[model samples]
Target: MAQDIITIFHGPQHPGITGNMSVELDLLGETIKRAETHVGYLHRGFEKMIERRTVLQAFTIVCRICVPEPDPNEENFARGVEELMGLEVPEKAKWLRTMVLEMARLQAQMLWFAGQGGSLGHYISPQWAVADRDLILDLFEELTGGRVYHMYITPGGVRRDLPEGFLGRLGHFLDYLESRLPEYDNMLLRNPVFLERARGVGIIDPATAREYGVVGPNLRACGFMNDIRKDEPYEMYGEVDFIVPTETSGDVYGRAMVRRAEIEQSISILRQIIRRMPAEKEIMAVLPKNHRKWEVPKGDTLVKTESARGEYSYYMVGDGTDKLRRVQVKGPSAVHAITLLEEMLVDSQLSDVAMIMNSLGTNPPEIER
Candidate 1:
């Protein structure tokens, strides 16, 4: 029997679709037979835009490209520029950078938790998850003066060192979050609605994940032990001790469980960074008076960091000029586009389309740019 193929566009602004990009889905009844992704709905000239701006100016703009997770871009850009300048970042700054990146990870995961739960039709869970996340953002507001897009981490070092008794306050917040993990378990993790909705949904197998170059929690959920923190160990990660969570299921539920456990790991990492961090940390470096013409020796550097979604890479090419010759960003959305969303949608119900795609944490802006 020849099934009728129905074409449906997922979203350009649909909250369920993650970011503002549409997907061309060919469906037979409720089953999606094929998916073609479109990305230009967002700002299309990100690379060209960066080349026009100064190195420091460009840093502020990079985060907007990938909203849900932005720190990795800051990290990669700062790291790339730093490598170009042969700048020696203070040990304290390195630990602090590691802490900041993980905090962003925790926040991104919080948002991911909410979005994933919502996608699977467990609406109440997102409320609880977002509520918990607001507290984390509150911490961000106090620390960086900005909750969502924190331009705290600059080229030389952070914008400023930890605030007065920042450690104690942060410690208290961490304690609060740590204590609330049990509630998340009761409310979302072990809740009947979530389990029923996510148990076997959006399943991505291990071999398929590896072949597609999946990274971070999604890949980890599929039983791959690939982690930039463990594998590369940048920003004082080598100094801390933490366990990378792994799951064998590779389903929606598996990723959820992995995310839940990973929160504990993030908390663990932050605590270690605080404990081992030096008291006299320099927030910024003394640079040349002329900020505009801040040129460094000629060199190109490729810096890759694992974000909430997966491995985010930045390729910085320099011609010994104040402005970067080229800055290229590579994110996990490609795999999400070609491998997961396209293949996973086939045979999946129309309703599950949003749920499945969002659960994968596909940020369209990353791919669109």
Candidate 2:
């Protein structure tokens, strides 16, 4: 006799889900037999929207591509436009952009910690991680006037220069964040309960990771030394010093550990930026005198940035017009949240669904966009 197969949706409303996305699962005795990804709950049609707007107008909307980590979208958009226009960004602006990217990465990892812990019924991790993450948000709010979506990075460079004594405040926060790392390790990384649930589960074969278009920490977790920052240095990444951490296990715990190590790396990068940043007052490049009728040269260029989740890219075209001829985004979530996720869910227990999703750093808005 064959067992009855049960069909169910894992979310668009469930707390365990990473975002406004659902996975349809065909299950038998709590083990997933098949999985299908469903998106469109959040914002959509971002590429179309960008194509219809002017360069400046389009800049405002790219940040909406990924809510948790918007800076990468902004960076990609800015760099793509800059390349098309042949604009040279100032040295100071480059360091500022790099700092913002690293700050974004740090906060995003904290959010991941919250999701990873919450999915496994470890409530303490969320509370502690969120509280610590808020410190970075506070710095963002001070720097960019927005906590979540910072529309700070622009076409040629950053929107403005840093405020007075801002680096001093940032340095202090970095110290605080570094000091709290041990506490995070004790509560989550070293906790026996977390180890039992995470170890050896949701393992991704290193050989298959690349074939599935895996990037960022997920790829690194599988022992690949791939990182956009190192491979293709942008902004001030070429000037900074950092290592791409990796793990051979390719499991939930290995992914978690990679992120843990990256938090320290982000801190180190920020410290280097703070020390070596050029002392220049000019942050923005000169734009056309007429803002409403600004036109770029006829050309297209591709730009990529290493976001918190993975590699984010923008392909932009200009036909000598005020509006862009085309704008296309290739975010990591499109692959990770849909195809890779569906494949990983098969034959896995239902309870581990959210844990697996969170480990991949799945974000639905990126998928929908």
Candidate 3:
């Protein structure tokens, strides 16, 4: 037997950045010969957890799929349940949900900045990025009551209405972020070091990207403009005007530009939502008399939504009972784990591991669970 090549487990605790997960690598010297993903660390049986809980209880757990960017989980579960129940959300609530999703997008992008920028020996940019991200989270706190894992976006509608003058605070934050964009350009985007390291590094062809089902910034990096938010126009996205930024290069730098450009677009979308939102409307739909007793007609549904990382889908099966019969979460991590991460790791420098993982935004919890 060709003594199964020497392999080493790289994470789940070591050099975090990617969170609690492990990467099995077969290595020859510095080259990665093969890679296998493994982690039951957070295998919380989230789907089964969903099965035992009420529709409302289940929504709260799905966010754990990607803690760094959780709103999309809420949106999917909420939308799925809404469709099954035939609940019609009010106009204002629709707009508010859009605003919440956009805000989550911005937050996740900021965290991505921290991951990407720090991976390649740059620190200030990520620090600034994360610090600024806190402002948006502050807004989240006022609106939804939690910072990191917000259990706000529920089926039928949001948890609560926006605070008084919330738009004014949101508008100010947007202006602040907009003004700082140029500074980011000056410090990081224009820096020669960042350019040389990022420009042509980690190139992914458009065909491969599509075939593997890449989503979010990585998909856009391949010059494909496919954002479910824009293409499908859920919530109030149809009412807003914003462009999906894309790049032909499909490298680290291309993703950086795509994310940076989208920051402005996100802010602009928020401004539009604030302006277009109806002044008065019911925020939450009439929910079941008792959440624990809530049951949907026996059937199945798959809800798809664009998360910051990529295409996030929630598949639910209702057994005509309060508890769900089955739930499956299919996120972009599937590609990032078994496919893209494997292909991207061979012969790559040790330094690029984190950057590559960050660029892909692989959420281990999502992939394993």
**Per-candidate TM vs. native?**
0.95, 0.98, 0.94
1 versus 2: better TM-score goes to = 2
Error of 2 at 37 (Å): 0.5
RMSD, one per candidate, in order: 1.7, 1.1, 2.5
RMSD of 1: 1.7
What lDDT tens digits, residue by residue, belong to model 3 across residues 130-196?
8999999999999999998888888888878878999999999999989998998888888898888
State the lDDT of candidate 2 residue by residue for 226-274, as single tens digits: 9999999999899889999999899999999999999999999999988
* Regions of model 1 farther than 4 Å from truth: 1-3
Q: Which candidate is the best by lDDT?
A: 2
Q: Count clashes in each candidate, considering only residues at least 3 apart in sequence or on different chains.
A: 1, 0, 1
| Candidates 1 and 3, the one with greater TM-score | 1
Q: Pick the TM-score winner.
A: 2
Question: What's the lDDT of the predicted structure labeled candidate 2?
Answer: 0.90
Q: State, as a TM-score between 0 and 1, how close model 1 is to the true structure.
A: 0.95
lDDT of 1 by residue, 1-369 (tens): 987888889886676555787878888888778887777777668899988988888889988778887788888888888888877787777877888899899988888878876776668768887897888788788778888898877787787667788778778889988998898788777988778877888888788888878887889999888899899978787889998899989987888888888899999988987788788756566666676777956778889898877889888898888889998988888788656777887777778777677778888888867
Q: Rank the candidate models, highest TM-score first.
A: 2, 1, 3
Which residue pairs clash within candidate 1?
32-346
- The global Cα lDDT (0 to 1) of model 3 is 0.83
